[model samples]
Target: MKRGIVFIATLMMLGSCGIFLPRPEFEKGMTERRFLRQNRDAKISNLDNGKTTYRVDRGERFFVLATFEDGKLVKLEERESRPNWMTPQEDPEKRNR
Candidate 1:
C-alpha cells in the first residue's frame, strides 16, 4: 500500500509541474527564416516596415497570427478565419469516416 501511495503521489507531482511551465509561442529572437523553416505552410504577409504577419492554421480552422519585427518574433495572437465565397479553407483535424 505504501509503494502504491508513493507512486500516485509522484505522478501527481509530475502532472502538476507541467501546468506551471512556461509555453512560449516561439522562442525569443526567432528570426523570420527560422520561423518559416519551422512552419513551412504558414502564409506570410508584410504588415509594415520591419514587421510581418504569419498566418498558420493550427487546427479546427484556428488560425494564429505570429507577428515579427526586425526579423524577430514579437507577438502571438489568435486570428479567426471567416469562410467567404472566394476564400479557401483548410480541413479540420478529424475527418468523417
Candidate 2:
C-alpha cells in the first residue's frame, strides 16, 4: 500500500510538471508554415523583419498585416479597401520653368 501511494504521488507530481504532456495536433513550426501557405492568396508582401501583409477578400475587401518575432506573432495592422490611383505627372521641363 505504501509503494502504491508513492507511485501515485510521483505520477501526480509529473503530471503537474507536464513531463508527460500530450503532443499538440500540429507542431508550432509546421502550424505556422501551414497557416502562411493556406493564406498565400491573401498575402500581399513580406518583409525580412518578419512582417507579412495579407489582403483579405472579405465582404468589402481589406488588408491585414502581421509581424512575428522569434517565432511568435507580435503585431497586426489592417486597413479597409480604398482606391489606388496615381495622378498624371507633368513634363519635367514644364515643372522646371
Candidate 3:
C-alpha cells in the first residue's frame, strides 16, 4: 500500500510539472531555415534589409505570421477571423516606421 501511494504521488507531481514547463512553440530567435524546413507549405515573402516573413494558414479562419532578420526569427504574430457579422474591415496602424 505504501509503494502504491508513493507511485501515485510521483505520477501526480510529474504530471503537474508539465503545466509549468515551457514548451518550444512559437518562440522568437529560432532559426529561420529550420522553421521553413519544418513548415514547408508556409508562404514566404522577402523583404528589404535582410528581413523575411513567413505566413502559415492554420485553417480557414486563422493564420500565423513570423518574421526573421539576418536568418533568425525575430517576431511572431497570429490572426484569427471572426464571424461575418462581427468582422471588422480596417487596416491596423503600421509599426517600425
Best by TM-score: 3
Please identify model 2 stretches exceeding 4 Å from their true place.
1-31, 50-61, 85-96
The local distance difference test score of each candidate is 0.81, 0.58, 0.82
Regions more than 4 Å wrong, model 1: 1-25, 83-97
> lDDT, candidate 3, residue 91?
52
Instruction: Give the TM-score (vs. native) of candidate 3.
Output: 0.57
| lDDT, residue 53, candidate 2 | 38
TM-score of 1: 0.52
Best by lDDT: 3
Q: What is candidate 1's lDDT per residue for 2-66, written digit by digit as tens?
A: 99999999999999999999665477678889888888989975577768998889785578888
Query: Candidate 2 on 1-97: residue-level lDDT in tens?
Result: 9999999999999888885675442233333455566555555556676655334454555766655555545555666776554446688999899
- The all-Cα superposition gives candidate 1 an RMSD in Å to the true structure of 12.5
Candidate 1, residue 42: the lDDT equals 92
lDDT of 3 by residue, 1-97 (tens): 9999999999999999999986575667889878887788789855767888888888888888899998888989898956687876565554333
The TM-scores of all predictions, comma-separated, are 0.52, 0.39, 0.57
Ranking 1 against 3 by TM-score, winner: 3
Predicted structure 2, TM vs. truth? 0.39
Best-first order by lDDT: 3, 1, 2
